[model samples]
Target: MEDLKVNDGIVSETLPGSPPAGLESYGFDQKDTKRLLRKMDWHIIPFMSLIYLLCFLDRTNIGNARLDHLEQDLNLHGLQYNDCLAILFPFYIAAEIPSNMMMKRTRPSIWLTFIMFFWSVSMVGQGFVTNYSGLMATRVFLGVFEGGLFPGVNFYISQWYRRDECGLRMAMFFSAATLAGAFGGILARGIAEMSGVGGRAAWSWIFILEGLLSVVVSLGAYWAIYDYPDTATFLSPKERHEVQTRLREDTGHLSTEFDFKYVRQALTDWKIYIHMLICMAGFCPIYSFALFLPTIIKGMGYTANDAQLMSVPPYVCACFFTILASYYADKYRRRGVFLMGFQIIAIVGFALLVSSGNTAVQYTGTVFAAIGIYPQIPLGMAWNSGNIGGSLKRATGIAMQVMGGNCGGIIASYVYISRDGPRFITGHSILIGFVR
Candidate 1:
């Protein structure tokens, strides 16, 4: 080893990104780091994935609830259902950057717990809303609270893992969104069957039961979720030092301290807007697909109940392929290049959906769209956060990109309006443009 140095017995290779030649000099080795990585994965990734799954489930369950007659009960008029979904984005988009900045000051466990509690409240309240205005009011609060979590998650992960290691971890976290899509269909199918139970409609049950589940999980999260590696109670003092040391060397500058300089760095970096453009491409199609998959499936001649059941397979395929893509992306250490290739897959999927009238063809398009749409989220997340240096800069950039993506969601909500249904050329064709 070339002149090794150790801080608290944590060491790295002589050059960052080189093989770890000097780890053993400080009583650390490949095996020790591997063990540490495994511990970190267990302590962090799955719980993050679980809460995010619930977060996504709560947001997109409106689609499922719609199938259970939300519109009929509310007497939603033309474009009103779409407006309800659209109502979420303004509060959601506006909150992204500020929420991340707020999280910077608070322990993530406390901050995340606080938001989760309120969003769950908003969700459960949706079940009790009796009219269009009531429904709209609940969605506004839902948007405000749910906005913080994703950017907070990206910031949290960036702090926990180095750039090279982030792709797979982000993939694992984002795969929960796909699983929620698959799982939501099954849950909705079951819940929708509970119509008229407890004097509640099936649509109401979708929100109430799911929201209550989230409420319980949120309370549990405060206890279960760990803070930084340094403060984590689960790790030994030695391992905590080791984890922090590894993280310090990964960045060009240690991101432990926040500065207004880094905040300005993120905002003024013009390249981030390019990343935001790509984010727009990735998120627009995804929100549309999630919010309307059942509607689209039902448009394909299936009953509402059957539509709920059938939405599963595409999302299952998406989860599998998303994990597969991230593994290879991490292994190869290429992001933008691999992403362009996958974008083509989604463009093809949208083309099939837009051009074909065949039911089998349309369903195939959905699978292609899901596989293509889902992977882009993690790919975009990892690519954006990995390139940004400071924790604060990463926080701002990721939130900015996500905010731009929310703009896509606004577009998505309106594109699938009922007038375009049965062969929503306007929707799928617009989606084709988005993926491209």
Candidate 2:
């Protein structure tokens, strides 16, 4: 099949391993494109991933802090911990679509850094929470600030990469959060070493020190984050144009302009709601894993420190599998079946978790959780955005779906009550259905 540019109806007889013809007219051959992509990889992927890593860590680090007696310290009883976790989402969901749209109206460099700094402050503030109300107050602010970053970053990256190339990049961003699970464990265990320092508990240190890094990184982001491909200070003019040309090959016209019609179209679209269901399916389980893995691992009868350390491996495994799945999905440009197919792994894992009495067997199930859930959520987001057209509409659609999707986070908070420990059959059984 010939590669056709729809707007001009220019057909290119493309050979294998070459970019669509006329990329050379912009001095963007396959080699130049690959070079430019690596440059983008260096600039965008790691930096955004670092920010996401910290955000994800801050959001769910309570799972680790719980291992250090966060419940006992605050007199948290029964479902208070669960309810506290749930409170963040209402504010988070309320803020996301507005936040996503705001990032578009202003510079992402301006909007996102503001978002990041405030959330980092919330992260730091969690360390000082002496009671339930204090924790809830900080979570309210955390929710309002943290809501913007995920959907905003998803839209930001979509601007820089073509649809077919986005799956792996999206998964890499997902992998950053998984790496945070691994890194969070390492940090949690190390922070445990500082338990009595300055009259603060290890859990307090967990919130303070990890949150401090995000605060620092957020400050530097004002300098580091590029607004758009056209305005990237690090890129040569030819490189920037070449990047734009590649995106244009996928989309005929790039309109960054804000229009109410697109916003209204996104608001009323039934397909966006269907896509929201897909987001819920993937995300409910991913959030379940993130917010409870340490507690879940400890239920397998390992020591608290050992459970903290043990949570690391499954995330490491997930990061590898998640990237591999996205790579092939992007390579083929057929992401539709990947989410549904890989989800079976999670079902099987959960089934093992529910039916098994053995600790090692259940540990294996946790490993499978990441393998399936981690990749599916980001791939789900990529699938949602790739189907939508126009940057404004895509951002709007993404924000809507993400806001709806995080309803799963609220669900996730309540699913694994502390009483369901040891087997946690109810939570595991419920997880089997989330992917389905």
Worst 10 residues of 2 by lDDT: 6-15
TM-score of each: 0.94, 0.94
lDDT of 2 by residue, 98-180 (tens): 89889889989999999999999999999999998998898889999999989999999999987767778988987998999
Candidate 2 similarity to native, TM-score: 0.94
CA lDDT, every model vs. true structure? 0.86, 0.85
Clashes of 2: 0
Error of 2 at 197 (Å): 1.3
User: Model 1 TM-score?
Assistant: 0.94
Error of 2 at 419 (Å): 1.7
Candidate 2, overall lDDT? Answer: 0.85
Identify the runs in model 1 with alpha carbons over 4 angstroms from their true place. Answer: 1-27
